[model samples]
Target: MFRRHGLRATAAACCATALLATPALAGSDGPGAPGAGDDYFPGYGNGGYDVSHYDIQLRYQPTDDHLRGTTTIVAKPTQNLTAFNLDFALPTKSVRVNGAPAQFSQDGTELTVTPSEALPEGSLATFVVEYEGVPSTVEVDGIKPWIRTSDGALAVGEPEIAAWWFPSNDHPRDKATFDISVAVPDGTEVLSNGVNTKNASLAGWTTWQWRTTKPTATYLAFIGVGQYEISTKTGAFGQPLVTAYSENLGELAGPAKASVERTPEVVEFLTGLLGEYPFEAQGGLVSSEGMNFALENQTRPTYSHRFFRNGANTSVVVHENAHQWFGDSVSVDTWRNIWLNEGFASYAEWFWSEAQGTGTAQELFDHYYASHPADDPFWQTLPGEPGAEEVFSKAVYDRGAMTVHALRNVVGDEALLDIIRTWVSEKRYSTGTIEEFIALAEQRSGKQLDELFNTWLFTKGRPPVGEATGVPVSATRVAVAPPKAVAEIDRTHALLHDH
Candidate 1:
């Protein structure tokens, strides 16, 4: 049976707001009010656009059976446009812009709105979307959204699943800041991006206000509401960070805390290695009910309860933590360049492994190289390749890790570290493409890498190995070894050389 990633199946609800639902007064400041700013607009086609600033407020309430909310987004248009389009990734019940009813079009996955009034370049525009629905189950392939049994856990993966809860761009390229307020059933907890600015109690419901100061990719935006035991800590930079796990999983808290307690250390390590921690307001981790792998949501990294099963290994913690630097701090401009996110995260796994004495960094490279398909067609496939379905594929993850490893080999460890540090320092709070990364690597390494990348990235099959060339051997005396074993041995030898 075909399986869909959870994000793709349940994301339909995220785009469900109607474009021209109601007209509101331009100056009216209601529950969902737009903030003062130049009408910020995101470019749709060509190179994706950036949302430099946004002031938005959302009023939401969730009953036992249904979730409802209205969002007002004030955006400054970065580019000139006569018509403004905002993406509601789900089916919308209603939409209005600047107190005027707007025309909307839908393609199931996107709700595009065109305001009745022409928006001038650099003008401020306000968009409002009101929606209500039964919280959809996240489904991908056959995998369904599930929560881990551990305490205070909630994660939204399957990229862009947040749209199921709110109208959004649902694409990674479009980045923005958000002010999210959510009301959950009385006694339940709610978690989201940014710092918790306010909390208030209403009739049988609790309201939470979360404001993210950093620019964020739409996919990294998140919300989780349920009963959870809250924990807090301070990073080396003194940034306040929090973690919430289910009360029932209280027993796992110690291990979970121990596993992640080094978050500050990891952050510091990455800051020294990469540049600086990208999101400064706060960082968080929420254990979620799910059998799938962890989802590196910005600020808050959602993890499966199982991850805490074995004392929250250093490798896993570092992997997710690394994302705060690579994925969250320096986001990929498009899904095709997802390697820029996942690959770096994967590489961090090796970096942590090497640091913790689990293995040398070269060992990690050999492991990935050994696992790579000899006849992989990933290089020939673009980010939006016809058959490609998910961004977490081997091409984006493992192969991408190998690319970084190869770069390290090409530039040596110290220089590779310098390149990464510069990349993060230069691109923090911004988005980058693969070509830009390649250029950055070249500049830092002081060496041409086009041929190197072509051999590993563009080739249809694995490039010829140095010693793999045909050499006559005594067939009768030749020793035969299992392919897997031989591969492992070869990798280990390569690792020794690399180290």
Candidate 2:
């Protein structure tokens, strides 16, 4: 996530006016544990089950900001299960497990469902949950991740947006395929991840249908319901490219279009380095709403209009799409390993800059290395193991990129790119860890890199200015600032990095 400074919560508390549908239910049993064992977010995903796919159907009325939905989940329990938990905040009317009425209750965002009978280990079970609520009213720790726009709603965020809009396992560890269909007024355009398989219109409402065959993290699945100027085109590699611009964007529309329309070019550029483009489609959505951050939501990314405030900026474009390979494809096993996402994506910005004749990756690395002094607090946060509060800190982003640059200097360009390609291919649709990445890097480069990684990623001070650390303060160091886009990112790093 890339955030601008001074962004405030924009959702208003609206009452849900949709009528609730009665659900079948029997006697209640017990609720399952509410976490999937990630220490950073203990209550995120429930344990004991693996989700295979989700079929979500939603109806939204922009006038009242009310949302109604039914979500069907296909999953299997790892062990015999009487009940399981789904991370959701909407008020549920009813729930069914395998066509039988199931007792359900919600404690905060944890929706505990007790099926009529225990599911046998390895048996596939189906869960159907019907819910209706005003998504803007849902809050977690005083933060509301859902963005309610004037024309419609934007269901986007990191680590937590799915709970407010739909029931989910709610973690990167439990990735699943998605078929999301959103029904809205005729004039509204609904944009989501993956392909637009179909669109059906009835009366004055239209249901925008979309599906993703690839396994995607719940946080990466999103929907934008609003009035948008939609465009479709074939990409450089023959993949479908879809881009949307909010009709309300005034002066920012041109710059946003100019930058995002280059998605094909950017994807082709990244493909040369990261092996192949992982997804089937490529696109971007530029919201006119005053959002401070841009999110990489699976196949299509959502950008804040503020990213183009100065002018056309493709660096942020590179950052979010680079996430397709780093954060989206090969996800972090745990949130603590976030540098694997942010660092590599940030390094992609440097790579793009060099390709555009703006700045070399080394020049960008050296600029950041010299910018922060030894006593700077920026060096205090360890990028490899940033705690919950510091997960999106500047250290995780810039220092993380510095770490990648340092690795490139030590491993050589060919070895570093090969290591990245191998890592992407090996961990294609699953999660990865820092340890695994370290081992792979060392193995591929034929180097003992523990000290180098530890000094840059784990230690709590500015690394020495030397070749070993990749910040050689020799005559090669030129006194030049990075491009405006990078300088803008540096300026925004001091702001909130909300998911």
Give the candidate number with the greatest lDDT: 2
State residue 445's C-alpha deviation in candidate 2, in Å: 0.7
Indicate the worst ten consecutive residues by lDDT in candidate 2. 14-23
TM-score of each: 0.77, 0.92
In model 2, residue pairs whose N, Cα or C atoms come closer than 3 Å (at least 3 residues apart or on different chains), thus clashing, are none
TM-score of 1: 0.77
Candidate 2 structure quality by residue, lDDT tens digits, 32-127: 456766666666777667899999999999998899999999998776777788999889999999999999889788788989898876788999
* Clash numbers, per candidate: 48, 0
lDDT of 1 by residue, 312-359 (tens): 544556667788878787876655566677678777766766666665
Error of 1 at 379 (Å): 9.6
Candidate 1, residue 167: the lDDT equals 60
lDDT of model number 1: 0.57
